[model samples]
Target chain A: MKNAKPSSRRNFLLTAGLGTAGVAAAVATATRGEKPRAAMPGATEGSGYRLSEHVQKYYKTTKV
Target chain B: MARMKFICDAERCIECNGCVTACKSEHEVPWGVNRRRLVTVNDGVPGERSISVSCMHCSDAPCMAVCPVDCFYKTDEGIVLHDKDLCIGCGYCFYACPFGAPQFPQAGAFGLRGKMDKCTYCSGGPEENHSAEEFRKYGRNRLAEGKLPACAEMCSTKALLAGDAEVITKIYKTRVVTRGKGEEIWGWSMAYGGSDKLSDLPGGKA
Candidate 1:
């Protein structure tokens, strides 16, 4: 019983460390974003080249 | 309005000259003039790299700065195009352009330098968008048709990318990080196509 409590505390600390690392890993993945999308605002106005079909094409092609 | 820009990933480029051919076919550029080109480094070596090159449409364009006739103009979309009608064929742009984007058509036996022509970012010139006059003088205004430059679109490996500066840079950054290696200077590679790769192509330089 004398060493039992200390080992249990150590085990708790290890689990907490692993949990923190898991949370950090999840946060990092979430921030990285799921799909790579670019901001090309006002891409359809003025010129004859509207974003219509080509924008779709770009989406499929520029995959990271 | 989205500011247009071009980016090429040298690591993926195989020096196929596909971009160069696509540009010529799109613009019908004269026999002697090339709006785009490819430069390779380390031919027949281990680290050979190739890149597509053309007008970068810089934020501070040297061509626009040096032109005496003020023919050069930057579009609302940040495309730097020139008015051939106003150009004096002075060749100042050829010298001023860091990428050698300015090109002259050798139209005569006397080595005559015709009107200065360069990559318009496929946005045409000062003329009305999608106009016939615009096509004859500046080639097709694909941008007016809501498209990126043909060279970028036609790139085989998708090494060349064209679109808004923010978008392309973001995409390129994503690729550099995802691929996890090979440093990329996107615009610089296309602008200069650095000559330091170790080529491994068969039968020497292709």
Candidate 2:
């Protein structure tokens, strides 16, 4: 067998492809089981009282 | 940090009672208690109008003023919530309310009046948020879930708008400006009277 390395173009493409897959996998793991982000600012789940995400949704619907 | 409020556009309401259903389902409210209701003016007439009615959560709530046991309290967001544990079921709040928001469920077979219940603006009562007892006593803590009141959200026609007073007022104003008419918000004058001095009217109070 030839003792030669792969072409630089192939090596760069392989590295880029692996790097993107690794980043996407990390993101998916980090976000797993976490609650969705609130649509409105300053709204937190399990609160006494705060402006809520539903307000944002309502605003969208009421757009005139 | 915004003061919560509800504004129902009478012109858009179809009297479908979807809001009532949503409220009931969300809270699993017991029988004979309605936290929200519909009121139609000039029913069966050409100029008929339907408006969803509930606790307006007034800035200076009359219910708070009249509660004998002092169970009523106002949140930072201006929501008027009462403690069922402390409520005496005297019905004074019910009588004092302009919209008749307070409701007393029949507790016993003889129709005994139970503790008062009303709209919490979907913020729930003083109980722990998202707890089973809280859900049982009040309704779903939609506010805690970063959601608005079910009745307003479920309104198919977007008639009922609930959120920060400024935001909803802006939405309503845009609709009014676009329509070029119906500038008179249905319950705004009654629930929250304007700054028009009585002396300025045709009849002089001064």
Candidate 3:
């Protein structure tokens, strides 16, 4: 009812760490048949872009 | 030159999952690849409401920014798309997306994550329109056909509206003013955070 109490920061950190490990495992499995590249971090920015008005409106509505 | 959007009116959503079915059927999205879903708050109570969610296709898309391989790109209509060829299955997009929009199929041996998949807003992918390759990679190109998204079209309660922002906002405004119960839900801060003056909140800038 209250949206699971907004998970604790510790829980979030644990989950993030576990998730990263899981993704790394998945990536390892994926590249088993192919050559593996060194892992890299995500990009910090993208080409300057914005959502259309239609997409913007989704977040504009009031919560029920 | 306006960007398209999808607005879900939580008060009106019935959680029939019609939108989910429509998306899966329209895209043949395969098992475990949920392009859309219903998130309900206050379940089984008077104030219980379900909101359909997918990729908001954010303006400063975290997925695009977080992709290690620069696989994502934006369409002229402001739809977010990605190239399967460039994807490394690292799952950074999944981690970065606020809406949990991106999904991956476990293909190859050892449960490897396959190409990232999500709602294309019915505009399809980077390939040429209506080609088999495009269909295989990105599903259908319904936008080029001048049709609305399958999810919105199939929404039994008309709760999910997808189209040009101006058009959908006008429709929502009319509904709100006519129904007279939407002022509190008119902006993101209030609906999601229970605060109308969201810009004043920590880490927020309206």
Candidate 4:
């Protein structure tokens, strides 16, 4: 009976280790290099505002 | 090893909004969201000048550091980017950014902030290049085409420049030294309060 108990405990530990590995593998597959979804599509595009030639010259001078 | 940067000439701005239009047309940017805008400090005055403002994409990006989910990242070229999927819409980046670069859309009726949005410097997001998924989430993938940003390309006066830091700085420096008086404006010291020499500015030293 003592020997039987040890075998059962060893089986349980092996199962737990495999379960942990399986969960980790599944998570890795799910999240491997997945791109995040955008909250607002095209939200960062420029609004249609133009700078005049004179203003352009000023921008050129001030750039770092 | 050098990161890219932007230097706007507040004095040269004409408020014509060419860069804004170019950006909109190139990316088909949706209404109510401005990737670039004109900010006039002194309106209706003799000294009034329109300054174009957008993501400054700082070196020590506060958005990247503050993100709880490690969503924000930087490109090899120094362009700051973030993963929209990982973002929790916490609004920490918006508060941390000095240039007010981060933006969020209202998702919940209670005005809860959604995922953050900001300029990508035309590089697109963390998806496969030019994929439909990338387009749906981020926008156009102009960097894949080996072209400069549309806003800079479409600048009627060539006011907005987007390129390698060294190249752009050389162009600006040539113009400044030639103009002499504009040197104060060309380097960051005069623009953002540093030294008069370009090498004196942070990241300005070679």
Most accurate candidate by TM-score? 2
Pairwise lDDT winner, candidates 1 and 3: 1
Q: Is 1 or 2 the stronger prediction by DockQ?
A: 2
| TM-score of every candidate relative to the true structure | 0.72, 0.74, 0.68, 0.67
Predicted complexes: DockQ each: 0.16, 0.21, 0.01, 0.02
Taking the tens digit of each residue's C-alpha lDDT, what string does model 4 give over B1-206?
53556656565567889888876666666666677777888799888877777887777898888888999888877889888999888889889888887877665666587778777777788977655566656666665544456666666555566665655666666555555656665445543343467565344433
Ranking by DockQ: 2, 1, 4, 3
Candidate 2 has a DockQ of 0.21
Ranking by TM-score: 2, 1, 3, 4
| i-RMSD per candidate, Å | 13.6, 6.0, 14.5, 10.6
For residues B73-142, could you state the per-residue lDDT of candidate 1 as single tens digits? 8778788888889988888888988899899986666656889988988887887665557777898777
Those runs of model 1 whose alpha carbons end farther than 4 Å from true positions after fitting are A1-45, A48-50, B107-111, B182-206
What is the clash count for each candidate, in the order shown? 13, 0, 9, 18
Residue-level lDDT for B202 in candidate 1? 21
Task: List per-prediction Cα lDDT, in the order shown.
Answer: 0.77, 0.80, 0.73, 0.67
Grade the docking of candidate 2: incorrect
Which candidate's DockQ is highest? 2
Task: Please report, as a residue range, the 10-residue window in candidate 3 chain B with the lowest summed lDDT.
Answer: B189-198
Which regions of candidate 3 fall more than 4 Å away from where they truly are?
Answer: A1-64, B107-111, B184-206
Model 2's lDDT to the true fold?
0.80
Residue B107 displacement (Å), model 4:
6.4
